[model samples]
Target chain A: MNRFLKILFFALLVKPMVLLGLGLNVFFKAKLPKQGPAIVVANHNSHLDTLVLMSLYPLSQIHKIRPVAAADYFLKNKLLAWFSLNIIGIIPMQRKHIRDTSALFAQCHRALDDGDILLLFPEGSRGKPEQLSDLKRGVHHLIKSRKTLKVVPVMMHGLGKALPKGEMIFVPFNCDVVVGDAIPFNADAKCYIDSVSNALNQLLALCMTRQSVVKDDLE
Target chain B: MFNIPIHSFYMMTFVVILLITGSLIRWRLQVKNPQTDYLELKQRIQSWWWMIGILFGILLAPTTVSIIFFALLSFLALKEFFSIMPTRQADRRILLWAYLAIPLQYYWVATNWYGMFLIFIPIYVFLFLPMRAVFIGETKGFIRSLGTIHWAVMLSVLCVSHIAYLLQLPVKNEQAGALGLVLFLIFITQFNDVCQYIWGKTLGKHKIIPKVSPKKTWEGFIGGVITVTLISGFVAPYLTPLTMVQGFVAGTLIAISGFVGDVVISSVKRDLAIKDSGTLIPGHGGLLDRIDSLIYTAPLFFHFLYYLHY
Candidate 1:
């Protein structure tokens, strides 16, 4: 029943609002992973980021696409927590002080193990709207032991200006989502994180230059 | 049920036939030149089907739906205008109020309140917007912000709303009613644009405005004016109250104003160093790009009919 409601929620509300309310220009959509056992990392801005990223996939595969959000923020109250968990289908990560790093992303690792795609925002928390912040290293830690996982870097622009943090009203702004080539899990932690950061930066540059993959390839 | 003029059906049929012809030409071109890609033309043709479908649906629906649809278009156009132009951080709230005015403006149209509709944007919005921005306490770029915001509302909302206002106009002919006028204006304007493009592509020479819109040429402009004027003269009596001569004059006005509107928008995009307004329509670039000619023609045709018929 919850799964049915999740699909219904996305199909009815989220998809239309994301498509119409905020016009999205997705580039190199072919690079997105069709199935799971992968991580889609993007720069976090507005709360709409998760929805926009999730709406990129077909509704049939929506159950497999899990977004990793902060437990404290999403699970702060009963209603939000229930909605986020059941409807949004987010895997909450505890952001508080943790002695063991493995326990923190255990839920994320389990999701990936279940052949589910994880949508991660490596910026830890939503930073200043429309500006990229430092990486929190949580994503790198999550993917360290998982060598087979493919990390796809995505850069989203204009959502922050549309509905940034603390703003209730949404200004209709055209958004751009650029997907980069998938990166295999690197053994070295520094190399892995650097590669993800570099991939994201390159995607950001694509948005800045307004360069999109050939329209024919979009098919 | 709401009334859709018989002429609208004929016009829609004509458009569909044109679309079929366009598709056939593309198919033939593909067969002749296998290496050359016709993706852009293909995308454009596909978009036209969707556009015409939505337009005819609205025309068939009740008057309130048409008003609401126009209001949505105004909102979307303003959103595109705001998106492309540089907006000041202080005037963000002011922009919201500008969006809010869309429904109110359309409400006036729905109620047939012409007196209020005419002055609400030009007088009230014109005076109130700058005052609203002043409350933000940011005096920087005051003139620039107010200028762009005011122009955005005027072009996107006030000008475009005239098309919706046509539905409210009292008409002499019951068969055509107001829908025919709406259909006539929109059809002629879009038709004029297509005529200009074809003329320009085939026999274009002597660039009209090389600095702003490089592709526009004198041959195309004159060819479009003559063709649209003649077509307008032929069809005006059937669709509108205008006689053959009046239709010819109206067509000439629309053809010239449509060119002006296209160039005006082209200049705005040129200033921003951008090609298109936004990516709302698939091949057309944006709603603004598709309706740039309508922006000018709507108001002019509305006023022209208002003075003569209404």
Candidate 2:
């Protein structure tokens, strides 16, 4: 009963607020990722990127998808630390150390093993529009290690332009995420990792190549 | 109850006048900007629908129900405020505390504990939150964490409780005391927003604060204040124990404060690089869009009534 009340409370209180923050993304005529235990890899651009992803999924599925955020950023401040963990359910990963990366991979593997979907941004950090930052070994490792999990390459277009890096002012624009076909996993672990990386690059290329409405109108 | 028949008649007349004038102006403008005609028409329809709902709700709903509705409004508004503001993972515990503060603050207002409501966020919550963080002994981003928590509570909870505090006012009659005041404040503030938007679109050339809020104009501000003041001046005696001049003064204050509230929230949105605080309300951008004017107006209007002994 207590758990139900808590869920109801969140539905009434937090969900409405989040939907408002995300601009009723569910209402938009767009597609979403199909199922769980899937790795959703997209380009990282701004803080709003997480919100965009969260908005795409149903409210009940929010807990099922753990956003892999930088531990340094989310854990850096006390207030943000609480919001990221409790409110948003972000999984923090250390960016710098190799040992930290291994531990983070284990946690990801465990989460996937437990049938939870992982929201991973392969760029590892926020970057410019259409530019794919060097693929962090995290995504490669997670794919190679987990035999059951499918790597769904998602390309988030127009988010970077909407809310640019190091800027807090958002220009009114439409953004869409394209969830491509899942990368097939094989017995050869190294080959599987390479295939996933290539799939992600192709997805990013599709995003970069797609003509934006605003850009076309301007020209 | 005060003369219900007369109040209903007055409200009906007010709504009719606003609807006719707004429709006429919107039709005239539609010819000039054919592309934006549908969007403008939709906005007008939505605003009218909201106005009707609010008017009917005030007339029909009990005081307690109305108060709860307003409290819910404040909750959504505050939630929007925090969503845009950046927070780190370590701050999740503090956000949990922030979300919990909403009900407690409203409860204090419901129980008429003005003394506690006033200082709950600034004094007690402020001291207790940092102490809780200190207990964890993770002092890395302590100062930044504490500041965000403090700011969020101050803006969302402490500031918004002023609307709740309106529910505690003592009037000549029991029913007219608290709930009536809340209704009066809301009516004046929201009407002022509508009038300002209408007037601004019609005759607004002189920008009030072009950089912060381009849509806000001096013409709109004056028009909103005058319209609200006149309406409040006429309605004050029926709702509360205030004279025409006092009602006008209150209306003027509410209008000005509402403007400030709208601008402050807009500035916050600007800082966060967000358009609308959230998109819960259709036609309205977010919770912030609905209550942007209420944030400053509530606190100022509450204090004003408190000092006036009404």
Candidate 3:
């Protein structure tokens, strides 16, 4: 039933709603790994961002991909909790438990161990749509603890315009989910958080420059 | 029973002429310019066939189906227009209302409620959407966001809904009927686009608006308008309630208004920094790209014909 609901909700309703409802055309500039146990990190902008990013994955991965959502927000009510946990397949992290990150750590490991793809916002929370803020330590520790995990930095623009962080109405704006090359974590990798942050910035800058080139060609 | 009317034959004749012109262009290109490629020209003609197919399909379908068809086009075009406009996230739910407006506006047309159809988007949607935005409690960029959303609905859904309404106009011309009015308006406006482009290419020198659309030229604009005005005079006697003079005026009206509509949408694409609205139609950028002129022309013609004849 959960699988059926996931297929119905994300694959059927949510996908078309975001793609057609929001008038978004999703393109993956970077090739995705056919099989993945990679930890995907992105800058959070809107609630639509998770759906937009998830849509980048092919339909076969509807079940394997999980977004790390705030447990308290999505899981506050029983029906929503069931919808989030079972239907959407989101891995909830209790943000209220400021110090105890281990529970989330265990859940992430368990999912990855089962060869499921995981998505996380390294910023810890949604920020101003355009600004990519300083990276939090949670992402660094997560990568460092698991040496074999590959960290893929994805940069999405226009989504901040599509549905801003604090806004409820999603203004239809075209968004791009740019995937970067998977950065494999090794024991002694220095400043991993800063590097991932820089990579995302680079990807975003590259997209902006490419967009200008398209405009120039139009001229 | 959906019987093909005399005006439907005229419409089919115009399409057939377009088909022959395409074949002639292909043949001429093959023989005369062996080294040059006519891919773009070929693609344009190819897209036309698809457009004609969908349009005539709807015209031949039951009235309910035709209404549904235009409503869907409005939905897609509005979706594309709003998708790129700078709307804030908190106001996302407001878009649901905007999308809802498409079917509702079209429903008014389907039921032939002329008074309600005319004012629904202009009045009700205008007032209702802001309330939705305000409910979200976000003040920043509120006016800008609200205006763009409302503007998109008005242009894409509301104005385009007038096209569907034209089909249901109470016309006394038995041979023509409302379908003729719909076809006359669409054919003249859309073909005006093609004529101007061709005329501009052949004898264009002066750029009308270089900054906005570099391709538009004085020669093309005049040539296309005169050509459409003449064609409208010829068709109106059979298809419309207008006399030859009125037909010429309507043609000129459509020509200028069509240009305004084209450039208006061009300005939008320019503002949004997009080349095309969407890629729904092959060779035709998006649905909006093909129908921009008609969006402005549809309602204008509907009102003009409604007052003059209906």
Point to the candidate with the largest lDDT: 1
In candidate 1, stretches whose alpha carbon ends up further than 4 angstroms from where it belongs are A184-195, A205-219, B1-4, B31-36
TM-score of each: 0.91, 0.61, 0.78
Model 3 CA deviation exceeding 4 Å by range = A28-34, A37-39, A70-81, A92-115, A129-131, A137-219, B13-51, B87-104, B123-150, B237-245, B278-283
Error of 2 at B90 (Å): 1.7
| Tens-digit lDDT string for candidate 3 (A1-27) | 778777777777777877665554433
Q: For candidate 2 chain B, which ten residues in a row score worst on lDDT?
A: B1-10
Question: Quick one: how many clashes does candidate 1 have?
Answer: 0
lDDT of 3 by residue, B184-286 (tens): 8888998899888899999999999999999999999999999999998888878877899999989999998999999999998787667876656666777
Give the candidate order by descending DockQ. 1, 3, 2
Q: Considering summed lDDT, which 10 consecutive residues are worst modelled in model 1 chain A? A: A209-218
Candidate 1's residue-wise lDDT over B1-310, tens digit each? 2445666667778888988998899899999999998999989988988998898789778899999999999988897787667665456688889988999999999999999999999999999998998888778678877899899999999999999999888876566777888889999999999999999999999999999988999999999999999999998888888889999999999999999999999998888776877777888888889999999999998898789887
Q: What TM-score against the true chain A does chain A of each candidate get?
A: 0.92, 0.76, 0.86
Which candidate, 1 or 2, has the higher TM-score? 1
> Cα deviation of A206 in candidate 2 (Å)?
18
A49-118: candidate 1 lDDT, tens digit per residue: 9999999899999999999998999999999999999998999988885668888878888898899999
In order of lDDT, best first, we have: 1, 3, 2
- Using DockQ as the yardstick, the better of models 1 and 2 is 1
